[model samples]
Target: MLTKTEVVIGMTFLVLALLAISVLAVLASTCLVYPIAIDYFGIDQLTGLSRGELIKNYSVLMAYLTRPWVNDLVMPYFRASREGLIHFAEVRRLLLFSQLVAISCLAFTGFWLKRLQGLGQLHHLKRWLLNTCAILLAFCGLIACDFSRAFILFHRLFFQNNYWIFDPRFDPVILALPQGFFAWCAGLAVFYLLGQLILLYIFSIYKEGQAL
Candidate 1:
């Protein structure tokens, strides 16, 4: 039978491995998306397309890109595709997939921690896990912000042809600002949750130690 400490450590390793695998999978999917997009949609389509058009194109690309067979080979190739070598869709897909994987990993980690708490063995691990989660969340938020800024800049510089149709000027002012603002809010929420978890862990440890 696995001791509590062993279980905790095993689960931690599992979660980390899954997270890493998911990140790699996402990156690979993204690489495939780019070339396929460039081929089907064309550079002009990518640069000059409206947001709606881009989304529609992306959906179509993802449909084909994420097939089981393709995904298997595409992932590592994406990692290999350095700066200018890869397609935009490849990068985009990777980012999208990575976020999804991260979210899933975090959720699973939380679920496991909850189980540990129920078993009365989570006190020591919870603090460290919550702090790690908070840091990861903050990093994710920063990445999201960077992507948003890059997307906007890419559109402004390259896709400025359809000025009237693709105008994001007003959208940025009203909606995009809030979107950026909420990312910070999300980071803070993660930080707060980490603090709460740490407190809970401390209380648990104290209570358990007292009972001994």
Candidate 2:
């Protein structure tokens, strides 16, 4: 009963859903591991010490603190380390909650795509969905590249001598700019995608009436 164009659109939606789910998993893992690794490795304490002291005795601290290994390996360890611990439990709870929200969003989007496919309206889906997806993928890729640069820039601006810890006021403002920009872009993309889906639904209804 489905046409070739509808089938292609459905397949594309399914693929995008799968890819978004995978990205959610990766982000969740990263969020879980980063803090734990910082604590376990004592990166903050190490970095807090004078360079002379680090050079003289804790040379390994430089490698441990500055290396990409913390981002990749240590973060997950930090996430697992908090289990059964009373201290910093609130932070862990919040992290888990945040991850849940992100995963839930991805899951819901995937469900919507599935619903659209089931409605057999793929062929007439708005052009905006494809454009939005493409833009989102590109935006994410750009942010990934920018992340490293931002880290270095922040370090140079604020952390060259001081150990960067959570400062509620400045930290939130500094973090908000990049996150807010990305969120706005992603929101627009999702809006466009949803609009396309709506158009597809209308087209399907029109076609059905014509056949009747």
Candidate 3:
């Protein structure tokens, strides 16, 4: 048996878990879609570098982003200014924060699920879950509709400095990473996240069916 307060807490954790899962899915999709984006966008010709070089450099960047306590990050073919390096370091912090939130919320959700199942109250949470997904999907739709604006807004909100506005002279890596690639990443991330939410929604519905 669960108390009303426990139910409230569990539902809150469930929502946080869903949100964190969506964020992680987006980041994973962005990383996974690099090869496809490179081929699709003719990044090699754009950067005047071979595909192999591009891949190697990008791999280094990704590794640096995921790693902690890095003194300096370097690109084989491009020189990064202090501003560029600082921006990337900020991005790494954001990624680390998201990972922590997702892991913590997921652990709590696992515990909550067992309690809900024991009480046969899984279906009771489906409405809130569906509502949360709907809200997220709506926000994604808005961002997709005006991604250029959203992109700028996202930077302004997250970053206090303007280092994201890269100068090709100092940061040639920006040539390899075009705005179009980021737009594609956002689209793909939304697609992947939607799929996850759909599965979760369906599972909630199944629980509802079982309860009845």
Candidate 4:
């Protein structure tokens, strides 16, 4: 049997892993997520560029986003979003590192939990963890359903300044990015979290029945 300390540690790792998954999903769904945004919401349109120009501009823009400082790039779009892009690049870098740690925690804790508990009453713990995730994901779903308000709230949390607000007069790139794009990303995160919760619930029932 797993000790109480082991159960607590393993449960903590599992919850952190789930939360990291949710964070990574939404962040990885943005304009900077690469080929995912090659087309404007899956359409062939660039803000101020023609077909021949889009390929070049798109490649340069994506590359610039990866750099923390790209002052040499004389692009209007990049300059407009320069500060926000730099901040987002930093955010993405940090999230990637944290995700690695979260995965390692899940793997180590999960292996030990399985070895020590051997799928015995530990099924209850798993079910409880899943239930917790379900409740958390339910809140995410609510945010997705009312995303405009959520988006405003999210921006306020990250941005102390109004750099995120783009003007078409200066930043034509903003036209290509509709608010619906963000809502879609939020929806995906909610669905992924909810699906995991459901799968865990189903598996717990199956294992419990087998034990009986």
Q: Write model 2 residue lDDT over 1-212, tens digit each, in one string.
A: 55677556655554455444443443434333434434545544644533233233222322233333432222211222222122123323433454455466557655655565567644444444465557756765675667556545644663333333333243321221233333433444444445544555576566546645
List RMSD in Å for every model shown: 12.6, 13.9, 2.6, 4.9
Off by over 4 Å in 2: 1-24, 27-94, 124-129, 141-145, 148-212
Clashes (candidate 3): 0
Residue by residue across 16-51, what tens digits does model 1's lDDT show?
Answer: 544544444544444444444444445334255454
Evaluate model 3: give its lDDT: 0.80
List clashing residue pairs in candidate 3: none
Answer with 2 or 3, whichever has the higher TM-score: 3
Residue-wise lDDT of candidate 4 within 74-108, one digit each (tens)? 45333455765555455445556666866887687
Q: Roughly what TM-score does model 4 have, to 2 decimal places? A: 0.65
Candidate 2: what lDDT? 0.43
Q: Give the whole-model CA lDDT for all candidates, comma-separated.
A: 0.48, 0.43, 0.80, 0.61
Stronger candidate by lDDT (1 vs 3): 3
Q: Give the TM-score of each candidate.
A: 0.34, 0.30, 0.86, 0.65
- Indicate which candidate wins on TM-score: 3
RMSD of 4: 4.9
Ranking by TM-score: 3, 4, 1, 2
Error of 2 at 94 (Å): 5.0
> Where is model 3 more than 4 Å wrong at Cα?
1-12, 26-32, 69-71, 208-212
